[model samples]
Target chain A: EAGVTQSPTHLIKTRGQQVTLRCSPISGHTSVYWYQQALGLGLQFLLWYDEGEERNRGNFPPRFSGRQFPNYSSELNVNALELEDSALYLCASSIRDRGPEQYFGPGTRLTVT
Target chain B: AQSVTQLDSHVSVSEGTPVLLRCNYSSSYSPSLFWYVQHPNKGLQLLLKYTSAATLVKGINGFEAEFKKSETSFHLTKPSAHMSDAAEYFCVVTGERTGRRALTFGSGTRLQVQP
Candidate 1:
């Protein structure tokens, strides 16, 4: 089966610009999650979307927000990007009722220069 | 609060050798544990999970992990390592009791397989 898929494997944007990352979950999956992996750092949870609702979010600022569509795809938006915002953004999806062994995507490498 | 700690930042093992990656988690209630492997430029692949089921969970790529309640640990292990097994491994725990869907991840351990 097709696994989780992310768009724009690499993205480059100037500081203060905004960027949007997309993710398509595996077939029949209902939950989508966003995470950020900063340079030399571990993955930090960003947002969680399920069944067209923004279910939960991580410790990120309001500048980082996302939404899930009825089709189960999701988009993460980051406004006023800073150099510190540069990192690998990953998207994962899984069944809402299943345990949280989320299948992640290849991730989009965001570079804020 | 829920947190995961990977005991080692990195581990190197020769092909055909046994592989062990240690992970410890702290949760006030019964937590769901998982092990995920991420290859270079690839997404995280689910190795296995323990969610109030069998203590020993086996996953793809000949990988498995056992959840030990006493130790508050969920460590990944393989009988033998393969060159293709080289990747970054993460231990995750979810708040099953708290009814949280988000999974808390560890710092991750990089497994280096030497042929």
Candidate 2:
């Protein structure tokens, strides 16, 4: 089976612009999660969606939001982006009923100037 | 609340030598631990996971991790290092206390294998 897949491997945007990253979960997976891997900041959780509902989110600002579709694919949106927002955004998916094990995607690298 | 700490920021080892990556975790309840490896410009790959079933969990690519509940540690190890094993490894933790299974990842340890 195919693992999680992400779109737009690399993106370049300027400050104050908006960006959206996409992810498609593996078949039979019901939970989608978003994470930001920034330089010096390491990896931090951004959002979690399951069964088309916003289950939980991290300490990130409201500017960082996302949603999961009925097919279990997800899209992360960043509004009024800042230089610090530039980082690798990764998406992971897992079977909600199963344990917490997750499979990851290649991630989209967003560069904000 | 849940968190993970990778003891080493970087480790260098020679080919055919043993490999050890240390990880410590904190959680309010029983935790699910995982080891993920990422190659340069590549996605993270699952190396192993401990989900309360087995204390000694073996994963893909000859990698394994032992979970020590008393020590709150889940360390990854490999009997023999290969050149392809050079990558960044992350230790992750999640628990029921962390609602919705939000994962807490470590700072990551970069492994370098010398020929």
Top model by lDDT, which number?
A: 2
Pairs with backbone N, CA or C atoms under 3 Å apart (clashes), candidate 1: none
**For model 2, how does the per-residue alpha-carbon lDDT over B1-115 read when each residue is reduced to its tens digit?**
7789999999999999999999999998888999999998888999898989989999999999999999999999999999999999999998866456888899999999999
TM-score for the A-chain in each candidate structure: 0.97, 0.98
Backbone clash pairs for candidate 2 read none
Docking class of 1: medium
For candidate 2, write residues A1-113 as lDDT tens digits.
98999999999999999999999999999999999999999889899999999999999999999888989899999999999998999999999877788899999999999
What 10-residue stretch in candidate 1 chain A is worst by lDDT? A95-104
The per-model DockQ list reads: 0.75, 0.84
TM-score of each: 0.96, 0.98
Clashes of each: 0, 0
lDDT by residue for model 1 over A1-113, one digit each (tens)? 99999999999999999999999999999999999998676899888888988878788899998888889999999999999999999998989776666888999999999
